[model samples]
Target chain A: MRPFTVHTGTAAPLRRSNVDTDQIIPARFCVRSTRSGHADSLFADWRDDPGFVLNRPGHRGATVLVAGNDFGIGSSREYAVWALQDYGFRAVIAPRYGDIFRENSLLNGLLTVTVPIEAVEEIWAAVEADPAEPVTVDLERLQVRCAGNVTAFDLDPDVRERLLHGLDAIAMTLREEELIVRYEASRHPALPTTR
Target chain B: MGSTLAQKVWDSHVVHRVATGSDLIYVDLHLLHEVNTPQAFDGLRAAGRGVRRPDLTLGTEDHNTPTIGIDRPIRDLDGRRQSELMRRNCAEFGIPLHRLGDPGQGIVHVIGPEQGLSRPGMTIVCCDSHTTTHGAFGALAFGIGASQVEHVLATQTLQLRRFKDLDITVTGRLPDGVTAKDLVLALIATIGTAGGQGHVIEYRGAAVADLSMESRMTLCNMSVEAGARAGMVAPDATTLAYLRGRPGVPQGAAWDAAVRGWTALRSDPDARFDTSVVIDGAALHPYVSWGTNPAQSVPIGGRVPAPADFADPEESAAARRALDYMALQPGTPMRDVPIDTVFVGSCTNSRIEDLRATADVLRGRRVADGLHMMIVAGSAAVRRQAVAEGLDRVFAEAGADFRAAAGCSMCAALNEDRLQPGQRAASTTNRNFEGRQGKGARTHIVSPPVAAATAIAGRLAAPADL
Candidate 1:
């Protein structure tokens, strides 16, 4: 996992609300042992239309995505986050996000910043007016900046600290393995029970 | 302050608490299936760590296994590989794998409670979203992502943030022909999808307490559809009776001790909740999703809602898009909407009771011409029970495809049981997300009786209409 602190990149504005994980990457494309190649399947169903924002010119290579409220609102699949990161998005700025999707993003090193809907709309307007404009997301400052407009965001301080240090969940969980073993032993106190 | 049931279970499971951070909570049972565990197992192998508690962990091949063909290899290549990987991983990790032909093999959520692994006062975590089904037994069960799955496999613990308590109180008796499915759908419709976000819902009041254990499971199972990770019903004599002689349940002295402990797991009379809502169960009709989301639903007999009915611009736009995708007219009655197929199995409603409910509606009647209806049992045990009761014969006689066993089937299009592009289906599955069944496929979520009646009519219909 890479530590995420500050990122500056072109922002892609997606004006759709309730953008579910199903549309992020369909279930048919979720197969495969490795997590790579998800970029090809990112928004695969919506890409056929030339007018779709991702397929339109000037949105290519954008690393920041500004989407409407309730983004990534279906399924517990982590593949949604994988596809976004694989598609070169370092961060997603939305008014709100699906709880599971937000957790997946944090665990996988993709930053998800939540702000007021008006703040999101401001970024959307700025990004839509000038596709080449770069947006900055600073975890240390807890703010998103674009075109002289800066809006503060809120993330749990613990999550921010972990993301800043590139600490993976498995390692953090393993640190408390002894305590877990003791707790388990206390709960089911018997011989090696085989089911 | 009297703690809620969720708080009781959560506090009891806390192994370690970090200052101003998440707590490390012990997982009493961890469930997994073919699709989600591959990456978790890979992570464990990469770390050179083995499963810490194989006895506490259980695996099953459901999402990718076929319901129709049990004697042969899975025809879908990806499905086969997933099932095979699950078998190998479980075997290597010393975790029990309920393989394709195993009696216990079924949808992870169904078999958990069926085998009594889902008991009161337990903290259960699974990789699938519908694991909330176990919460009906007074367990604190919820779903987690792949990384969390690996975390549990390695340490038998999960880092957690406790959720606020939301009590959904349903009063009054359910009207005839109305079921738990209708009640849950109505709740989701009233609250909208994200209404329960950040809260663990406890279904209470007269209506929820009156339901059977299976029906309670049905109600809790769809909590995820409403953005709630967990939903629980307090254990009582009903829950105890349902757990009496199941596979993993205790007996004699142990049974008495377990019952005593479970009896104390209910919320206090004066327990306070962050939020509470009351629903009139008697007023709920057979509900169905008319749009791409579970929250966008109407009663089976009601007319499709116009976009103008929504006051929010985002909701209105979503309604319009749903109308386009579902190919529905705003003012048309829901009964007039035709369906090409009907699916009668999923974790949401695919128990023995569900099959019997469908069979009751299908008996002495035939599926309408050009309509395809398939019924998959929730598990092999459910299948055997259905067959013994002659439900399979009734389905077969009614011209419905009666599958012998369990798997995800059409609930998720992980195998061959999928609808073609632009095809519409009346499904008992939870989600009606765009292309959830298949690409370009439209799903209208309904209950077992509604699904059966729709198949017979070749259109959306409730049991009363028959």
Candidate 2:
């Protein structure tokens, strides 16, 4: 994972709420033995239709996806985030994200930005007007700015730190191994014997 | 100041707190499956570690093996290799293994509760996220990754952080047609799929209190949908009754003492939560997902939402995209969405009760033409019970495909069974993600009755419609 700071790129409009992992990378894409090379498969069916936003010529190179509420719902597959990253998306702006997907995204260094529904709409309209127009998502300020407007929201500091540093939950836990060992030593005189 | 279920479980299991704010927590039960066990076994082997406690660890083959004809060797070489690897790993590590033909061979989640290995006030971990299903028995259960699996295998312990506190209380009696499946769908619809993130949800209130053990498992099985760490219902008479005389549960005087300890596991009356949501069960109706996500759902009688009406612009766009993917017209009644397939069975609703429910709908009826319907049981045990009860005959008579048991079948298209491209299906499985049933397969989440009814109509329909 890279440690580059995320700058919101062009906003690609995705109008639906609760965009599940399945749609992000259908299960067929998951059958591959290797995890890499899923970018082309992201939304393969939908992207084929010329009407799909991602397929629309104007939206080419859009890295920031502006989506509806409750995005990324369904299955705990980490592949969803992998596909999004492979597709060149650095940030997903929505009213909310599926919990597991969000955790996976943050762990993999994908930024999930949440803003008020009203602000999300404004951003959506701005992107729809000109799909090529860029939206700036500033991690330092915890805000999304585009079309002469800026909206700020809260992100759990722990998550922010993890994403900024490209650290996953396991890596974070491992980093504090010394503390964990000491804690274990103090809690039980002897580890409980398993049956 | 208030303790969440996660906090309560975390506190009780903490052996020591280190100055760096991490803790070493004891793990009570470790569930293993073929897909994730090989790597852990290799790690253990490389580390020169023997199985720390074989009795506490349990393994089963579900992900890689075919659901049908356990006697035959797996035709998929990759799958066969994975299964064989697990067998070898377990043998080398001295862990108990339940191969495809074993009586205990089933979904790890289902086998744990059925055999009474999943009990109240225990901490269980598995490589599968749905391990939260064990929490139905009042245990603290969650999924860990392959590395964590190896660590736990070697040490019988896990390092962890606590989650936030949240309680979703569904009060009052559920209406006659509503099952635990309906209740969970309603909850997901109301809270959105991400509502439970970073939290361990405790299902409380009168309605939850009234559910049976099987029903409780259905409720907790989908906790992953809500982004919850786990969902637990405190043990009561219903839980104890379900566990009594089970193959692995306590017997004699120990049973009495176990019950006493289990009884005290409930939240105190004064216990508070950082976040609380109250649901009136009476208002809920059978729900089905109209779009790609579980939260993008409506009541059986409701219509698909128009993208223009959305309050959020991004949501409006998403609605349009989902409408396109699902091939649904705006403002069309969701009940009118045509379905080409109906699937009943998965870890979510493939138990004996689920089979019985589908059978109730299929009895004396036939599935409509052009509709492909299949029933896959969660386990061989469930299949045998369904056979003994003649549910298979009813399913066959109704023209439904009564196939042998398999994991990730129609639910995920891991096997040969799948929805054709551009075809829509009504499934009882946990997810309706894009292509979850197959590449280009559109899934509409539905209950067993709805799935059966849709099978009969060749489109989405209610059970009463028949």
Candidate 3:
């Protein structure tokens, strides 16, 4: 995981809303056991069209994705988040996101910025107007700036702190192993088990 | 203050309150499948950590397994490798796994309850989003990503924020043709795709209480479609009856003590929620999706909605896109929408009761000429049960293709069973998102009976229409 303090990159605007994980890296690509080779598979179906946003010459090297509402709306696959990072995307800005997708992004250090629908439209306009214009997503300031217009975004405090530190949450939880053992002994007696 | 069922379960699992503003809660069970778990194993190996509680974690191969040919090697190279890797990984970690040929092998969500592993007041997590199906037993079950899967495997805990409680109380008896699948579809249609985001829903009132355990699982399975992480029903007589003789359940005096606590898992009479919604169950009909997402649905008798029907510009635009992708015309009767295939199985509705009810509808009917209908069980165990009940003969007699093996066939089409380009299906699967069944495949999400009737009618027709 990489610490996400601030990032500035060219933004690519996805006009469609409710882009699900199945569409993000289709089920076919999901078979690959490794996570690093998914860059080419991101939006594998849509990318076949020459006119797809990311396929355009100007949007070719973008590292920030500005999409519509309910982005990543289905599936709990972290492969979707891995595909974005594998494709060099540093941050994703959307008005709304699937609860699980947002959580996956936080753990992987891929920043997800949520703003009002109006602010998202503004960012979309700036990026669509000039694909070369770089947009700044500042985690420290809690704001997204594009085309001299600044719009603020909100991130959960719990997630924000971990992303800022690039923390491995597994290690943090392991530190409290004693507490976990104690908690287990007190679990409901009826809870089922496996041999 | 009175606590809701979700609140009680959630509070009971809390191990520590972090200064960083989230609760660190212990996980009682963690279910794993072939997809999205190989990376987690790799991470665990790299960090030199062993599974903290292998006994509490269970793995099963389902997503990429074939619904037919249980004896042959997996044909897809990538899928075969994934399956092999999973076997090796589980072996290395000393975790028990239900192999593809084993009777215990089935969809994780299905086997969890069947094995009596999902009990009230427990906290369960899986790599698949539909893990919420276990919440039907009054457990706080939800899905997680690979990183979280690894976290739970290593430390048996998760750090997360709390969710607001939403009470969805359905009144009156559900009409004959409208099953739990329809009820949830109607709910999602009323509340848009992201309606329940960040909330945990407790289904209350008469209609919910009347549903059987399988039906309750069907309702909770699609909670994610409404953007909710978990949906639950308090444990009661139906839940107890289903678990009484199942393996892994508490016995004798232990069971009595457990029942007392389970009975208390319900919401207090005066419990307050962040939001409350009441639904009229009698009014709902068999519902089906007209577009790519679950929320883009309407009753079987309704007509396709025009983009203009949506007041929000973004919504209208989305509707337009969905209509274009689905190749549907506005104002067309949903019953008249033709389909190329009909699928009657998925984690959502592939249990013995579902099979029996759908079989009753399909018993003497003939599948429309040239239209294909397929029925696959949620697990090998389910397939065996369906066979013994003669549901297979009924499906075959109805001119449908009843599969011999069991897996997530056609639902996800991850294992060579899928719709081709320009193909459309009336399926019982949870999602109707673009190409979910196959590349360029369009789907109308329906209940098992609706799928059966649609197959016989060669279109989207309910049993009542027949």
Best candidate, lDDT: 3
Candidate 3, CAPRI quality class derived from DockQ: high
Off by over 4 Å in 3: none
Residue B447 displacement (Å), model 2: 1.8
Superposed Cα RMSD, model 2:
4.5
Expressed as tens digits, the lDDT of each residue in B316-340 for candidate 3 is: 9989999999999999999999988
Q: Residues B1-466, candidate 2, lDDT per residue (tens digit)?
A: 4455556667777765645555667777898877645656775676576666677798887765666675788777656677788888888777787777777677788878887788887889887777878889888887765556776877667755566667889989998778888898889878766788777889998999899888899899888787787889988999999999987577788788778877878776677776899999988888888887677788889999998977856557767777887888888888788888888987888888989999998899999997888888877788889999999999999999887764546776655677888988899988877778887778898889889988988878878877
What are the per-residue Cα lDDT tens digits for candidate 1 across B15-46? 99978667888888999888867888998999
| Native interface contact recovery, all models | 0.36, 0.25, 0.77
**What would the per-residue lDDT of candidate 2 be over residues A1-195, giving only the tens digit for each residue?**
565364857878987766777778765555443335779988876787788888877888888888877777665556577788889998889987765566567666778888988898898898898876679988878888998998997776665665567654444444555655564455422212223
Candidate that beats the other on DockQ, 1 or 3, i.e. the better one:
3
Residue range A82-171, candidate 3, lDDT tens digits? 999999999999999999999988899999999888888887888788888889999999999998989987787867877898988898
TM-score of each: 0.98, 0.83, 0.99
Clashing pairs in 1: none
Q: A1-195, model 1: which lDDT tens digit per residue? A: 789999999988998888888889887766555556689888888888898888879898999999987898777777788889999999999987877788888988899998888988888888788899889999999989999999998887778888999987778878777887677667755212336
